[model samples]
Target: MAQITLRYIPFKTDVAFLQIKQTEVSGIPLYIIFFYIHVYSAIFVLLAGFTQFNSYLLKKRPTIHRNIGRLYVFTILFFSAPSGLFIGVFANGGFYSQISFVTLSILWFYFTLKGFTSIKNQNITQHKAFMMRSFALTFSAITLRLWKIILVNLFHPAPMDVYQIIAWLGWLPNLIIIEYYLYKQSKK
Candidate 1:
């Protein structure tokens, strides 16, 4: 009995490992390409935002801030959100994952548009609020990848399962952070 159980254990482990390997290998090249694009765009947006924000905080350089901010928002709105949304549709797992991606895409557009509109109307406070929200979604690519790593390590779930959790896992924390930031801003 003991020998049988041990034998099965290794078999199960090997099967699981094979499953992961198979999925990773067979997944489309487009999937990998989109994944890379999503991650790089997030990094680009974050770096641009950090640079402009730091300049504003230290030197109060409005011109530099405005120029970088334009580039930042453009990246988020035009490049990041669309690619994310496309990738979200192709996201593995199932319908809930798809819904999460769709929701994320809408929120991305909404907050970004709000920020742009607020800026046009000279509403700095609102602009900041919306920009924070937009940035939160932009950061989701990073969060999603991190969550996938964690979930897979912990549960060794299937690729679809990981993808589903990642669909929600990626952006949910970002939204929470945005709420916290907005709350802090309001407190001040």
Candidate 2:
């Protein structure tokens, strides 16, 4: 993921993913801005979020957990989620994919916010649950691209067509799996 992201470094317009998005880059003035914001801030989210789940770090180094957790929460709230919504509005695959991405941004923001508030209120269980939900959505960035590749290879569908399917498929299943795990954990 970091490798995929690093291709955009120094911020050139005619590069990597931007090569395919020329239409959006030229047409929508804010598209490039939001796209860059989403791309840059997402790396931080992935890094901080990964550390936040380390049991050893959480137990023996709670201060580290809280610090990285703050990075995850604030980055999502201030940068990632908002920029995601902006780009999602003009996403490929038309309204279907647009709606899916937009919904994802909203849920991602809501879950992360709830997680942060839960911890602030000293509700560890709720914090865990909400952060789980938030991270599930965060993982969608990778899953969405993976789904696109798989769909393209298997069905040879148009790029936008595959994107429409993946926009929902990517995050929904992740959230479902996490929810199931959370459910079973609660039962235990």
Q: Total backbone clashes of model 2?
A: 0
On residues 1-188, what C-alpha lDDT tens digit does candidate 1 reach at each position?
Answer: 12322333432323422344345325654544454455556666777766754744537777777887888878777777776777667656779998899889889978988998899999988998888788787777567777877898889998788878889889998899889878987898
Best by lDDT: 2
State the lDDT of candidate 2 residue by residue for 1-188, as single tens digits.
89878999989888998888899999988889999999999999988988888999999999999999998999999999999999999888899999999999999999999999999999999999999999999999889889888898899998888878999999999999999999999999
Worst 10 residues of 2 by lDDT: 12-21
Q: Where in model 2 is the C-alpha error above 4 Å? A: none
What are the lDDT figures for the candidates, one per model?
0.72, 0.94
Among all windows of 10 consecutive residues in model 1, the one with the lowest summed lDDT is: 1-10
Listed per candidate, the RMSD to the true structure in angstroms reads 10.2, 1.0
